[model samples]
Target: MSLAVNASTFDQCLTSIRALPDGTDGIVDNHGNPVNISSNATAISYGLCKEVCGRDSGAFEWSVFSQQFSAWLLPWLALISQLPFGAKHRSDNVMSMLLTVGSPVLGAYSLALTVLNSQWIARRFSGFKYPNVGLAVRALSSLQQVPLEVSAEYGVLASMVVLPENNEWWTELVEGLDYIHTWSISAASSIAWVVIAYLFTVIDSFANVSENIQANGQGVGSVWLWLLPIVIGWLQVSPKCDFDRVAQALEKANRKAYLADYPNPVPLSHKTGRPAFVLQHYRRGSVHRDEESSAPIFNYARFFPWVHAVEQVAEAFERASENALSHVPVGRDVPWAPSDVGVHGDNRKGTLDDVQARPRRGSPIGRWGSDVWTRVIVASALALSLQWGTTGAAFMIVWFTPTKGLGCRSGAYLLYGLISTLVWLIMLLSSIFAHYSHLPHPNSQHLHLRGVVDETAARLSVALRRIGKFVATLNAVWIVVICLFQFSSFFDRCYCDSSVIGLGKRAFYTLLLTEEDIPVLRGAWIGGTLFYYLFDFVRTI
Candidate 1:
């Protein structure tokens, strides 16, 4: 006779199985097939067997296979459904596009900046006076002297260019100065992008792991362990990117040089008992004399009153001699003259119009509201809030979820934090090397010791910069690889029963339900990333 068991008899069956002796005869099926129960069979194995043999076996298997699959798929479907009806899809699409497109664009932009800065630095110090000095030493010297040189040379060259008659060298010098200014701004922008991208990656990685740990009931350390790098890295790198600070520094340097160039006349006497003359005039005359000393000496100005007269006479005589000795075609030998007044009329008129229109541009408050520092402050606040909110949410989820594993997630989370800390440390070391390298060589009685110290610092700075560049390049490549892996894993999770992209993606996405659960975090992440790209782009321009 066939025996039928209902839900109430299921417990009886379990009891009978548990009571059966280890060496007893096994039960037989309807077809008279005998099945032996092993002594090693456990309650878990028996339960699994019942599950497999149950009428709902298909549902049970599907549920087991679709744990992570459904977790992501449902949200994806929801997102897709909202595409035509809501702004949610638009934002999601934009984020996805940025992940796919903006990353490479930013990477290429950074690479270009790196190349340009490298070329500029090399060219800037290529003319070091001492052949014995290494390139690193020259670079350090150039960096240290950049403010002074830019301030002094820019004003002088600019004045020459503004004059009615100027040489090609003056124009080129002015252009070179402009190039340096542009490069400084670009360098600052590049560093900012690097720091922002780094923080973005760290936050995203933490959120990914957090979701998994929370869902799986795993205990991990505080999120501050992950956030500490953000604070430290920002403190180290943000000053480099502050446009206001850079601008103020440049302005102060220019003001100092300007003052030095046109200092107030102070009465003084020469120890040799020469007449008290305007020192500025004396210094200018001496410079002219030194420059022309190789040529036939002109009658030296004996007194202060005779200086300008003597200079004019000497310049005229030299010009006449040069003309007599040189030969040139009549057309090409035309005397140099300033351009006609009419030639600059359009530019002058435009300048006047621009001046007149300035007042109408905006109110003082509006201008202040649009200032660079204002934007920076606002962006920073938004980014910090986003980071904190996302981290807090993750913690809250973990706190409420029933987790079985207590410390399993800590190792991986700490590993990520450790890597970030190491990178920040490298960056800090590089900054320190750069600072020391640019310091003025100390005045000491022991010249040899001073030289050795300076050279050592320069070499270390050079090596550190190279290392930093390599690390930045490697980090960019790593980010690209991670992005690709994530994309592939996303598709694999949706289509395949198992992840085909390897265990890295499998482990990463195991607990992550969706891109993000909170709308604010999802939007903030996208906005913050795009802000970095936009900020860099604007700075570059």
Candidate 2:
């Protein structure tokens, strides 16, 4: 069971031991030559089990900082920040301009994380850099304050009040949009000068540092893995709207006159006032709804509920199965009765979901609330899925490194991440287009409706609303695809472990590494990933 510390010579020794006396050893490397492994790898594996991970399992902190934070959440937050406050997608505005020009925060934070985690950067930066529990909680509270992605649906209603042919509301928005742009442009230009003049070399140095980690396989920065997520927590403290001011402004602009002017804000008719400004807005070369506010962007938020529901159900079944295993009668023990716990949980979830789904009889989620919730749910799922999916794909990229088809893995993952993102728009547009034929359909409850901009916004709005289910389903599919690929691209687990684990040492010695087992190991990896998603998919449905 004793493992030799001299791992460097392990592979060569294994190759010799595995070779049969008559030279019939059949294992080979990627180049394909006779090799040995049958007796060889087993010795090394026994040593690993005896040394590192004994049969007994133990507690390990979730790698939210190292694997999850660095791998996914960090990059995802950076991407989301590029969008304007309360906006879902980035439009051609000052926000996008700022993202392009003064994105030093992005570069700086990314560099800082890598540097902090760099074991080679010196001893100073590499260790337990995450904030304490109290600080992290306060920092996280800032991100959760406004819930821009959730509140975005209110944007449609807000837009109705905020946008008119000639009103302060409309002027404020346009001004706000431009206001952000002017300052952002100015700041970006200033940053660009410094970047051009001095920081280019620093940028190159950072790239070299990153390459060093990737090339030899990022082993150094194990100690300082928790900082970036805390930083992301800091980033979440987005600018919030003062609801008190909003109400005050509403009071100042007398309700009746405000409704008369911004009639569209009132979901139902005012029992008076002119019809909404559908004809007027479209009549001239005024800003198109798509340009001003891509309300459809919020439509995808519907998947949030579905994703939440899916997770709950999956957890439910997983618990049920685990409980069932624990309760199983061991070899002629007395019979056990089925537990009602899982059933009760399911009933409660279904009851609540159905109540919310109906949106009538004083249900909060009915009607317009339902529309908002649906998109919020879906958008949330997509966001999480994108974060995890890209993270998974990145892992896949790292896995394939130093193998024969390394370049192929990079190409495959590039396509995977890009396609997964674009899929949202593709399915969204397709679903909306399909729903167009349905016409002015009744929303969730078939409640009596208003027809202000029905001729204009109704078609697009209804299509967007109806499209949520399809996109939600598609989101589930994309999640499984990326997770499965991630698991499959786990091609180098043994190789990476070779630095320490005895099985890895054995594999390296006997040529029994992942590249050799691709044919059969692929099916196993796929089955495992799908099995993991199965509970999720069933619960979602």
Candidate 3:
């Protein structure tokens, strides 16, 4: 197959494209061929081009040159271009909000959470399944399962490129301060994204991305391990095809019908809704973000990782309750019933699912270091819990919940009360469910000895210990709620700062918060939450 290029067309259009700023991303690594317009109805089309640029860097060089050149014309625009369209000046808007996570020192942490949250939701709701498969294949499938969108990544990076810190205002913004923390945070965030964007663009992360090299389709997932090699190989070559007569053949086609024979239709400024100046972004045309595989669809699902994290925390609390209830001694007249669930599966530890509960033999307790002191500790904890609920007892014996000042947020300790009451009810109900399902009481050999109250207490204990798992399983709603609030930029109502190091006395609910004398509460929350999840994820793996 022959590809065509017209030297005069590129020479004529170079200045117009070079003067473009906003459209730089679409053309960064764009590739397309020269095709003469019929009746001026045809338009210039560009795509993710590789071979036609002579070398990989050639495309990158052209993209950067045009970008730098546009920067030089910061005080200029509305240029006339070869493809016949005037460039409309574009500026920052909500598109810039994708990178709005900057400003707090926790920029990278928030970014990582955003990415992980996006991945977790994609995994949870995905209809696509990886069947019972080989380990290597399953792992690879898992890798592919978590797709990162290049388009989204591109949008974020493009914003960072034009962010305030990268321009002249950066100096004035940092003028008097010996060290500008927020500016530094913004700079760091932009730098990190610059690397991410380069990889996303240069490596071609978009899935099933018009593998025909110069065609159109939609999908976004990638095997960067493989693309890395391809990029490296392409970087070493300068491609030149012997297609001298291809442009001549196209030039001779006067009838538009002849152009329809080609599978790849040329995209003109009119064909695409964008202005010609926007089209001038990449190699005399523009490239578009593909949407396929459901992952790239932007929505609230992107913040789901935090939901998963909170659910896990809730589950942990439930497990603590379960363990405490299990140790409580039965009454004097209540005959001790064995919990050995009539001999279930082999007592293998790691082989069992973390959430799955099996009956345990009630013998040899002292051998495992459960002596008088342990019993005393348990009894004391139960007393305190009965009086003050788990949160207070938890505070007395242990250092209490790691989420500091959580209790202070509510009126008269009402928040902890709400949390405890909810958890207690959840545990009691879940324990009851497990009793019905697992029949925690081993088939009572004393057939007539089954007492209703005794059996009820045993089942309730089991449920209390295991209620956390149920909370986690159905935690989708809470997760979505927290995510909406965490990154929410539109939270107009403000409140007092109950955060660990909240500003003077007030705090906003959303993470994109800025205040003097206090760290961004939401930023720190997101960052800390993300860090906990990272370790948790690692432990899980």
Candidate achieving the largest TM-score: 2
The lDDT, on a scale of 0 to 1, for candidate 3 is 0.23
Candidates ranked, most accurate by lDDT first: 2, 1, 3
Q: Write the per-residue lDDT of candidate 3 for residues 438-469, one digit (tens) a residue.
A: 23245577644555645555555455533432
Question: Model 3 misses residue 514 by how many Å?
Answer: 9.4
Residue 393 displacement in candidate 2 (angstroms): 9.9
Backbone clashes (count) for model 1: 1
Clashing pairs in 1: 217-403
Off by over 4 Å in 2: 1-22, 33-400, 406-426, 429-431, 434-541
Q: Cα deviation of 181 in candidate 3 (Å)?
A: 48
Evaluated at residue 467, the lDDT of candidate 1 is 53
Tell me the tens digit of each residue's lDDT in model 2 across 38-85.
Answer: 453323332432333333312222331244233322232333333323
Full-model lDDT, candidate 2: 0.29
lDDT tens digits by residue: candidate 1, 420-492 = 3344334334434443444454456887877787667656645653454355445434433332332232212
lDDT of each candidate versus the true structure: 0.28, 0.29, 0.23
